[model samples]
Target: MKVRDKVIVVTGAGGGIGRELVFNLLYKGAKVAAIDINSDALEETLKQAGGDGDKVSTHIVNLTDREAVEKLPEQVISCHGTVDGIVNNAGIIHSFVNINDLDYDKIKLVMDINFYGTLYMVKSFIPYLLDRPVGHVTNVSSMGGFLPVPGQSIYGASKAAVKLMTEGLYAELKDTSVNVTVVFPGGVRTDIMKNSKVEGVPSTNDTDKAHDHLLTPKEAAEIIINGMEKDQYRVLAGKDAKMMDKLYRLSPQRAVSIITKQMKKIINK
Candidate 1:
């Protein structure tokens, strides 16, 4: 679908790829509703958009709040007259702990935000999107959705749910005007790790080393928009993400083992 002149709602538009996406969409002539829980970060994103004030709107709402998310479609429609697309991008990571030791509350929080948030957005926006000739839903999964990571098991599970859920939507909407795209992004230059809900896990302080080959948020957002325009079913954002996708498809067991070993190396370092 053409992004130019589209009315798009991007959740979690305060940081990382979401922030860049808001700016990029504005540049492409799309009217954007930038939603996030962080008022300060959302203001920063609005400033970065550099557009006429009417072209952009900001909503500070927690995605995990079902009542709030349920009311979003009407608000967006009232603001923009109609909704052409929705990007389910809000997410949170759990503490880097094994399932046995993982905090139940933290896991619940992660699942509610990452998995249920995407579902809520899709559920809330479908009617509005169906009113359009062609609409798109871009749900951001992760490389961990396909590849099992040692410390982020819960995070991976939430993304896995997104993968299946998005694909299910694709199947259900195959003959419809609405399209679905799932994104699998590798490590990116985001503050996710720094702001993640990790309790006792030591931060990966060597940013340079940890993100040696990470893509910048701008680059990742560009890839996402390109994929959305083309209506790709699955878009891998980086070489590592593509490789992981290939490995998982070729041999799930072997891929899991390899990724587990790699995680061991990173954690031990």
Candidate 2:
């Protein structure tokens, strides 16, 4: 569905692709409700909106808080009159470590924010989306969701859950006005490690080299919004994501091995 004049809610709108999405949607003439846990960051996004700031509203929301999320739809409606689309973009990764070394708390935190967070947004807003003439649900998964990345097993698992759940939602809503899209993004330049409060992250030259080809947030957001506009079933946000998706489909084991080698540079031993 076209976003022009529509009220679109974007989670994680404080920074990275989510912030770029807010800019792009406003450029397309859409009103946006930006949600993020950081009030200051949300304010920054609004401040950057400049003349378009009037078309946006910022909401401080921790996506992991289900009660807060459940109240989001009504709050958005109250501000924007009605909501037509939701981009489930808020998520985080755990400290780079094997599942064996990862504690339960870290695992749960990853699952809660990455998988369950998206689930809550979907559940809370789907009913409202279903009622709209042209509604959309876009969930951002990851390349790790489809390919195994050593030391990020739990992070991959959470994203894999998002992948499957979004696909299922697509099938269920096929006959309805609500369009569902699942997105897989490869390396994107962002402050995810800092935002996730991940410890012991390597800043070695090798690690930087490994991520030198990462997509910019604006590029990733453009691909995602284009997919949403076309009502695509799946969107691969980077060239790496697109290539890896094909490789994983052809030979999962080989794909896993390839990524394992590349990730070794950054994964904490």
Candidate 3:
């Protein structure tokens, strides 16, 4: 669906890919309702918008709260008059430790935000989306969602659930006006670790790094929006994600081993 005159709601709009999505959507002439848990970060996103900031509305929302999420469609509709699409992008990874060493509280937190959060947004807005002439739903799953990373097993599981749920929604909504697209992104330059408050890891804002190997948030956001416009079934946002998706399809065991090694290196670092 074309986003030029549409109103799209993007979660995790405080920073990272989510913030980038808000900017891109606005530049594309789309109105956006940006939702995030961090009010300051959301304010920063608006400030960055400058003159076009009026096209964007910021909502300080915790996705895990079902009551809050349910009210989102109405609030967004009040702001933009109608809703056309939603990008469920807010997520966090747990500490770099084996599942055996991880606590239940941490596991639940990851699932609640990554899986249940997306689910809440999906259930809440899909009905409204169906009411529109052309609507879309984009869910951001990680490369770890498809390829297992030893240290991020729970994170992977949560994203895996998102991946499947999105695909299933696509099938279910095939005859409807709402379109569903699931995204798999590899390592991206974002402050997810610090935002997640992962134990044992120092607060290193990875978003500052100009590493060519990692996909920048702006790049990732562009890819995602492009996919949404074309109504793609799934999108691999980065070279690594594309390569790894093929690798996993060709040989799941080898893919798992390869990512396990990479995770070990990150954990040790």
Tens digit of per-residue lDDT, candidate 3, span 84-155? 999999999998888999999999999999999999999999889989998999999989888888878999
For candidate 2, list the clashing residue pairs, or say none: none
- Model 1, span 92-169: residue lDDT tens: 887667888887888898999999999999999998898899999999999998888998999999999999999999
Query: Candidate 2 on 168-244: residue-level lDDT in tens?
Result: 99999999999999999998988787888887875322356666788988899999999999999999988899899
What TM-score does each of the candidates earn? 0.95, 0.95, 0.96
Model 2 lDDT, full chain set: 0.91
lDDT of 3: 0.91
Q: How many backbone clashes does candidate 1 have?
A: 0
The candidate that wins on lDDT is 3
RMSD of 1: 1.6
Error (Å) of candidate 1 at residue 103 is 1.3
* CA deviation > 4 Å runs, candidate 3: 51-53, 201-211
